[model samples]
Target chain A: MEAAPPESAAPITPVLVAEHLERKLPGDPPVTLVTDIDLAIEPGKFTAIVGPSGCGKSSLLYLLGLIDRPTDGRLLLEGRDMMPLSGDERAQIRLRHFGFVFQFHFLLPEFTALDNVMMPIRRLGRLSLPGARERASDLLTSMGLGDKLHKPPDHLSGGERQRVAIARAMANNPLLVLGDEPTGNLDSTNSARVVELFRELAHEQGRAVVCVTHDPGIAEVADIRVSMLDGRICEVLRQT
Target chain B: MFPRLGLLLHIAAMHLLVRRRQTLVATSGVAVGVGFFLAVSALMVGSQTDFVKTLIAAAPHIIISDELRSPSPQPGVREYGKTGAVELHGYKVRNEVRGIKDWQQILREIDAMPGAIGSPSLSGAVTLRQGGRDEPLGVVGIDPTIETRVSTISEKLRAGRLIDLERVQGGVIIGEDLAERLGLGMGDIVAATSARGVSRSLRIVGLFKKGQSGLGSGTGYMLLREAQSLLGRPFVINRLGVKLPDPYTADAVAKQLEARHGYKAESWQERSADFLGLLLTRNVIMYTVVSAILLVASFGIYTAVSNSVTDKRRDIAIMRSMGFSQGDLQFVFVVEGMALAVAGVIAGWLFGFALMTVLGSLEFPIQGEVRHLPLDRSTRQYLIAAAASLFAGIFAAWLPARKTALVDPVDILRGAV
Candidate 1:
């Protein structure tokens, strides 16, 4: 697989930062999901978090994506403290600045690919219906899914479905894109194609991309890799 | 805002479409409830209005009687009021002539009241004797011109005009059935004796038919002056029949009259209180039964929504991760429920209208007359049915919508994928 190119000459600015984050589920003996996690995600870089099963890779990704709250930490989005925000405020921030993809495409089966991509655009309510439709079409076409926009998720193949989900995640022009094993369900060729697309999304569009994966191929293509062991980050690898 | 709302509606419609069978079942449940509610309410309200119309047409809105509900003190007792409270042995109550003294002045006062037209009348018991056959009858004395304004007696005349009684002195209007029973006709003279034994021969000038057996066979009308002379009670009126522009205000008007004037004024509604009370009770029972149907339909909605929520758990988690708020999820489901209710309401209205039209076209015997079934096509009944169905659907969907809104997307995602 061809590795992603190094960062351009433009100075890097961090889009998301986490300091001393800790997540513990309430129990007789609290189950710690992640601990002492400190990270900064810069724009125009593709980062991969790799770990064995149950080693907090997905948990750390969820925390970074703002989908899960940490028990003790300060998370800053674009240098603004996100901990004091209300649930609705956090949702608004997610709508404007963050996008997510899961291992399962998670596209609503009842909606056409175009509608699924338009979901975030319509939810943000910044675009008219025609505008949203146009934007969704553009994104799908960019993902090489022009002909399949009107098809339902069930009608599409696995790679097509994941690509549709990616187009949906980028619908609102979010600053950061987070994926949890997005290519885990794809074959080798489709997984390599998805990783190439992620690298292009980060380098060409100047957006931060963070993905959690066990696939060594995905980590090899990423510009930076963070490995986790027993709920803690154990190693950081950067490819020049 | 419009785009967001459209998206929510789109999603809600899509969810419902995914489970078309359950949607149909729930919608039909509400439809049936609303349909029955409209049909039954229209029938009951229609019959009530029809009965009231007949009652209003049959009699005056208010009747002021000269006789007091309680006995008046004797002149001697009034003159020696409370003098040592003397108790008399063998005291007996004697029946005296009952008539309104100074009734012309009272009539003038009543006529001056707003929206009121009062006519003096004297009703007494008499017997008609013709061909050696005697039948007991009620003799009503009325002024031809004033009585026509207060009662529908003029419209009921079968042979001659009520005004014809004025042209012929000592002329009376008898019901067609009464005239037939007595073997008498217009221009025929019949011997009549008052309860006081005063006897006279009166000519039948007009015949009236009211479609009621008792009224047709036992009542007669004559000139007020002639009836007073024959009954040995000249210059006396025992009753005042009153008509108003709006008959529904009769009770309030009657109360006002009774308070101002000491005569016992009774409204038509007051006279028929027992029947009206029965009608009201029937209405209560009908609403209870129909509301139970809606309640059952609401349970159908509840189950349908609950099932949808369970099936859409993964989709819900996905939407939440896509940045949809809790209110958005709740709004989508609630919109689904409201859509079903609205569709059902429309269907029910059409169903009820069709039923009413069919029923109204059929003829049935009612009180010896063939008529169409009463079915009120009032918009109020439609609104009530719609409002009830909507309320039930929303209430039923509330629990499931709340549950769906409170769903933890992480929990669902962890288990689902």
Candidate 2:
């Protein structure tokens, strides 16, 4: 898959916007982990967040993914205020519209590979069993893990498990996919392959991918790069 | 709805399957409690039913006694001061009721009484002579037509017809033992001699077998008129058999009649109170003991559910992340407990019934009691027990369920077990 930035004049509205977001770590004297971060991710655009280990990049990603609430700012998804939605409604939106990939894959250990991939899709609708099975199989097959349907996460390779996590994130056909150090635990070979998979998902499928990573090679492949230091964004580098 | 319910069932089934031994222990706790409860209750009610059956089979609901004359009065103001002077209170037995002069009139009046049923019976002792042999018999003069209303042995007629006590020349229904002793059978003639040297020749029309009692001492059944005739006491009956209208309230009616009419009366309850009392006492004691089993079973459920909540801490945390409310978590645990209880109840019911049947078939050790144990399921009692069990299961799971729901997802995700 080839990657090229869209024209600067593209008028697509931002799907996620974080304005002056702040989060504090609870302590005797509370420490500020994320402070006043202004960010926006538009539809059909790929962005990468890169910083050192203690830069709060993961916290920023979590806040952007709507899994963690900001201490002092509002989150807007599709320019609609997200603060008023009930917990169940928010979970439904996350399960239906947003996908997340964590460093460890976080696959439910007991379920099969296909079941892990199909969880969000199955949660979204009452599909017939065979229909759900077929969709899950197709997603895994496209990820190059077709024959591992019944295998548990423990039995799969580290890369294979992350691939399952990616297939799961994309299974609900979400508009935005967020990866928190998605290939942090993999070797260089597996890391490059996962980076290529993300590129194909973003450009060919026309979905936005915001990845949090410290790897410069993975960051170079993104069309837009936002770098963070301490708790705030230091620079935004856009490419065409 | 279908998909969610399917998921719920799938999850619950898998959880139970993976912990089969624990589930079995939980189920058996409830099952044993329920089984013992049902078995004991059934046997108690069975005995009660049996007692009623025995009384209905053996004798009438009411018995009229002879109008016993008071011996010379060593009297006072009749103790309660209801009478002003020293009054000789008449002791009435079966024979002396006002306007009940003849056997026919007594039968008519008894039949006409509200809620009253059955023809009258006259009882006396007589010796039946056959050729050179003689045997003393407890002779009863029966109204044949209404014998069933007065006694249970009416169902135990083995041969010939029940004697027509209304006949001028009444036939005798001898017990099998008496018949055997006298070497007499149906259609045979026997001569009966009374205490006062009064004699009558009677034809035996029926032979009865009552298993025990009213027979071993050579009892005889004859027409009421014939017994009165041979005794040279026309229009005189030594005893009267009364059948009340409602079998359930026989004792109350008998009491009312005794108080209102100044005649001696006896009910089936009054006749069999000793046996019925024994059954009631045993039932109360046994059921109280069985209920303790349910108490123990509830504790088992509490332990099982609490341990499950502990085991599924991470799962609960995931569920909370998926936006599960406290109520939702509560529902899951309560449903699990109730499922166990309901399963236990069904299993217990089956086992209890089977156990009762087995106990019923075997010769149980009731010492020398003649009554058999019975099982009965009253609707009220069954509902109370079921409600108690359901409440127990729910309450047992409540504490742990609440704690599980209140757990913060952040702590759980950070590797807290």
Candidate 3:
């Protein structure tokens, strides 16, 4: 716990970094999704990678999140090289230190909200049944979803489902939270609430968050914004 | 491992429950196939065993027939009539059989064979007169002390006492069906004519009814010496009743007797080959058809699993991206199929047992030497069917389960992404 940055620290060692990355789509006419890109995300920073359609913003985020491999690049997380680890080792890293919230909030339809949140912990195989349940309840309570513990995805509204997804991503106390258009499927009010939750998590909990979005309003609220175009990082801006 | 197993089981159960209709359709496919297999196999085995046991109870395991001589050959024709090769010339037809001069010697030789148990019996067509009515019947001479070794008729005595060895003068047991037809009762005296035209009055000491080969109904049993005396032969027998130590050993013993001695010995199975062959063939055909039922039911399982894969495409991709392996998904579907198969086998077994019980109580129609229906061996047949049903169900689900398990998670996700 002491290894984590304090809330008072304005900046610390960058937890995620990608340098000179390139990804090519193998097609009749090959398309380069990312090319010679360099980026870094500092701890406790609410950063958004924004770009137009067909830009490499999502690809760069996916590489930083350790969900996909870069064609020719170096990726480092917490000062450790991400390329030498096996797929299972990478998955363990994701399960332990990183949480992901996808565009669709892919909640298992058959499981209730509490069970969905408990899935990652259970998969870790380190906790007993009651221990996992307790952790799941605590996380849901922290996320202000205690009342919807037993509601299935279909029964829950889109906003509640997204909250459940967020709770699930944070179940293992991950250091970095990665969201890819998490509010893309929600309405304006729900989207604002989701962004507020992200801001609170980063500012109060002292956690790093990197979100990929095309929405300008979301980018405007971020402490740091990286704009990408044509598979290259065009500019980086900081809020005063 | 245990925790993973628990999680997998919970996940499988939830999926099955959520897709209740699909699960039911899959389970019912296996159950109905197994049910028909069990029912048909049980009935076939039961009927076949019943037929064989009933026939054995009424007859000996082995039968010996006296030799029959051919007519004298015509002059200037090199024609010899033999067992397999009979040459015919222009000669008058005549049959003159040599009497068994050394009857005691032959009986002793037959008894000396390994596992051979024999009793002398004399048979001939005779007219029996009782209460001013006459009926033609086949007369049999049996040694009372050893009669039970070959035939089960003694245990089926419905009225009066069985034949007594001490009463050597003359004692007879007549079938109940024959007794009824002749208006004869126990202890009634009936005059029986022998082949030599000699007549003797015999007491009906017992009456019996046989389920199969109702030769019991139209048969008369008397003392061996009495039959020989009535036929004007001092010591002669028309046939001998022979039984081996075990019913399955009859053929071996028969082969030995034929090789050692120049006498033709026939096992009961050979004597009733036509009937036994018919039953065995019917059983094979029926079992084949019932097993094929499962072959058809597997198609339903294939369709159900294929549909499930199609419906759960997105879920599969998410699971794969979350680190679930292909082997894991394989295990999931296997668990589903195994659950369905187990339920089907259990249900089919219970249903088969119930059917057997009902069949055991009901009377079947009489046909071609068989009167009673048998459900005694149904349990064993049901067990065989249950095993076959399970095997077929598992095999049927294999192809579909593999297809679903191996579908590229990345491809599925990319198509829908």
Highest lDDT among the candidates is held by which one? 1
lDDT assessment of candidate 3: 0.74
Q: Each candidate's iRMS in angstroms? A: 0.9, 3.0, 2.6
Q: TM per model?
A: 0.92, 0.73, 0.80
User: Once superposed on the true structure, which residue ranges of model 1 sit more than 4 Å away at CA?
Assistant: A1-11, B82-97, B185-187, B208-216, B259-261
| Candidate 3: pairs in clash | none
Q: Give fnat for candidates 1, 2 and onward, in order.
A: 0.69, 0.06, 0.20
Candidate 2 RMSD computed on C-alpha atoms after optimal superposition onto the true structure: 6.9
lDDT of 1 at A36: 98
Clashes of 2: 13
For candidate 1, lDDT tens digit of each residue in B289-311?
88898788788788888888888
The CA lDDT of each predicted structure is 0.87, 0.73, 0.74
Per-residue lDDT of candidate 1, residues A1-240 (tens digit): 122124635456578888899999999899999999988788888999999999998888888877789999989887889999877787888888988988999999999999999999999999999999999999999999999999999999999999999999999999999999999999999999899989999999989999999899989989989999999999978787
Residue B259, candidate 1: Cα error in Å is 4.4
Runs with alpha carbons beyond 4 Å of true place in candidate 3: A1-26, A30-32, A35-45, A59-97, A199-208, A221-224, A235-240, B66-116, B125-137, B155-219, B273-276, B365-372, B376-386, B403-417
lDDT of 3 by residue, A1-240 (tens): 123445435546777777787887789888898898877777777999998987877777777777677778888787788898876677678778888787887888999999888877777767888998999998888877888899999898988889899998888888899888888889998899889989988998878999999777789999999888999999989874
Q: Pick the candidate with the highest DockQ.
A: 1
Identify the superior model by lDDT, candidate 1 or candidate 3. 1
Candidate 3 lDDT over residue span B307-408, tens digit each: 766677777666655555556666776676667777777776676666666766676555333345555454566567667766766666566667755555
